[model samples]
Target: MVDIRSPCILVCSIDVKSGFCFGCGRTRAEIASWLSLTSQERDTIMAELPRRLETVERRPRRETRRARIARQRREGQ
Candidate 1:
C-alpha cells in the first residue's frame, strides 16, 4: 500500500462558512473515508488542498505544540 500522508496538523476545527477543516482542508465525509480511499484518490484530494486553502476565509492552522509554546514565550516577553 502506498503511503499518502495526511495534511492534518492536529487543529481539527471546521470552519462553519467553508464547511472544511481548518487544518486538513477536508470535509467531514472526506476525512471519515480517508483511510479507505485509494492512493490516487488521496493524491487527487491532496492536489486540491492548496487551491482550497487559498480561497478559504481562514487559512489552515499548522501550529505545532512546540511552536505554540515558543510563540507564547515570545508574546509574554
Candidate 2:
C-alpha cells in the first residue's frame, strides 16, 4: 500500500456555499471516502484543492481580532 497523505488541517468546518471543507477544500463525501481512494485519486483531488479553496468563503461571521484591528486602522481610530 502506498503512503498517501491526508490534506486535513484539522479545521473541519464545512463551507455552506461551496459545499467544501473550509480548511481542506474537500466535500463531506470526499473526506469520508478518502482512505478508500487510490493514490492517483488522492493526488488528483489534492491538485484541485487550491482551486476549490479559492471559491470558499473563509471569513468568520463574527468579528475577529485581526478584522477588528484592520477596521480600526481603516477608520483612523
Candidate 3:
C-alpha cells in the first residue's frame, strides 16, 4: 500500500473543547485541507500531533483499524 502521511486512527469524531480529533488530534480545517497540503505541511502537522493529543481529555473507546491490524499480525506470528 502507498504510504499516507496522516494521523488518522480510523476514528473521526471531533472533540469540541480541544478542537482536535480524538484519534488524530487534527482540527476539522486541517483534516479538510489535508489532501491539498504539501507533504512537508503534512509532516509538520504530524510532528506536532503527539503533543497536541496530550491535551485531549479522552480517547476512542474502540480499537482502531491500525491497532487491529497490528494485533492480527502479532497473533498470526
Using TM-score as the measure, the top candidate is 2
* Candidate 2 lDDT tens digits, 34-57: 999988899999999999999999
Model 1 TM:
0.68
Q: Judged by lDDT, which candidate is best?
A: 2
Q: Rank the candidates by TM-score, best first.
A: 2, 3, 1
Per-residue lDDT of candidate 3, residues 1-77 (tens digit): 55667787777767777898888999999999998898899999999999989988686556656667789999995
Any residue pairs clashing in model 1, and if so which?
A: none
lDDT of 1 by residue, 1-77 (tens): 56668988766766767878776788889999999998889899999988776656674346645457778999995
The whole-model C-alpha lDDT of candidate 3 against the native structure comes to 0.83
Candidate 3 Cα deviation (angstroms), residue 34: 0.5
Per model, state how many residue pairs clash: 0, 0, 0
Q: Report every candidate's CA lDDT.
A: 0.77, 0.85, 0.83
* lDDT accuracy of residue 40 in candidate 2: 88
How accurate locally is residue 70 in candidate 3, as Cα lDDT from 0 to 100?
Answer: 83
